[model samples]
Target: MASSSKWTASDIPAQSGRIAIVTGANTGLGLATAKALAGHGAHVVLAVRDTEKGKRAADEITAEHPDATVTLQSLDLGSLRSVRAAAEALKAEFPRIDLLINNAGVMYPPKQTTEDGFELAFGTNHLGHFALTGLLLENLLPVPGSRVVTVSSVGHRIQAAIHFDDLQWERSYSRVGAYGQSKLANLLFTYELQRRLDAAETIAVAAHPGLSNTELMRHLHLPSAFNPLIGLVAQSPAMGALPTLRAATDPGVRGGQYYGPGGLGETRGYPKLVGSSSQSHDLDLARRLWTVSEELTGVTFPVG
Candidate 1:
């Protein structure tokens, strides 16, 4: 709770007996976040699309911390059916969940759609997590100090808008614009969810990794010329995962707060409480998006 400017994995308090579900835990920032949590004595479920990769990631975590409890749950965020199945399995297995980290996401990939026909970025990044959180929220509602930590991105400030008229981007699409929309939706979802949970023990918070060197950048398609510059400026997955770790584990974190890098432009540094774009704070927009998300995913929060 002290100045987060110096916050790191070492600052994470003991997480013994906690149950954490981290999406996309197979690699990059997700892997780092999961490993750190497990190392801190939390039982972590690596909810991923690839069982093989999840197993490997779990193995890696246990190898580093022999006492770590790591499990795998098959999840494909692009498909609503998959999300529901994963949520059901999780609910049946764990009566309580302390943390739900919506960490998995797709970046600037070529225009495509998910199994549910929503834009890949928007569907996987926003709608998928929206439904999953709603479905699993019941497990957390009764547990005091429970939290839902959503991973957003600095890109949310770039070319981002609700685009209600063309939410699917069927008429036209710009990969950057679509990605930004999804990240911005993340904040909207968190703020609105927090409002709904005002009287509950559960809380909603959001964080961004800044410019981290991770697989998410595979689709960035930045010219080879920028590789050197990017490599120099981008932080490691461990560092990038700090904001998320702080958001999820920091006792001082409050509902609706956003965390990001502490350096200039919030490009790279240690985790800190960061400000979001003005549009992301639009209460009306958040409410509207929440309604549309429920309609699209057919998953309603119990808080509502």
Candidate 2:
């Protein structure tokens, strides 16, 4: 891998003895990430809400790389019970984990609530990953070079702020605003988690897939007049998965760092180290959000 060259899925190093668990690996960025990792010899676990789709994805990976090792583990981040069950199942299967990718998330959807009663986007995107990471910390602690990579989004730049007053949007709700809040929380969580895990070999990092053409945009409706313009700019899911792959496998990557596209406005292109919004770096806010998250999820990290 060239230091200055554009990073691609091929840039991922060998993972002959490694194990990785990727959330929402049924399709989109998660599937791309899992396939790339498995192609390099890693035993990839697709932690998906739908077992049938997950198995199909595993089969696809195996079909591409006959030597690939993959498995399916059921995980529904929106519900705490499901998160706990998935963690226990993973703990029983693997004593050590090399990578845990929080790639599963819900985008702009009609106002709704998760099974846990939290706002759909915030509950599934941030809190779900938060609880899952804390619950699975033990499996990662003993594995040197292990990483927890959370997938945020460039949409986070739009009205992204932690609404401490109404964390669940009990009073009012906006699909776009809630999505932004969730993505922003991903960065704060990564930064704060990295701080808490400073003494450990494992690290926490964040990445965004840029504007990818994936099913995540199912709820994103635009006027017919703007559809073509958006299509002309959005990149394929494989291209969008670059930043995440880099964050997960790049040897030089540090804890708390963010990765995204290097092209204009970070809309598309190869993966590179990128800067996050100033709001995303607020330490005070990160700490407070971390505390609130712990209380809401009832899952505590061993690092702290």
Model 1 residue 163 CA deviation (Å) reads 0.8
Residue 285 CA displacement from its true place in model 2, Å: 0.6
- The 10 consecutive residues of candidate 2 with the worst lDDT sum are 1-10
Instruction: List pairs with backbone clashes in candidate 1.
Output: none
TM-score of each: 0.99, 0.98
Residue-wise lDDT of candidate 2 within 186-239, one digit each (tens)?
999999999999889899999999898899988988777877787889998889
Model 2 misses residue 134 by how many Å?
A: 0.1
Alpha-carbon shift of residue 192 in model 2 (angstroms): 0.3
RMSD per model, one decimal: 0.9, 1.0
Query: Candidate 1 — worst ten consecutive residues by lDDT sum?
Result: 1-10
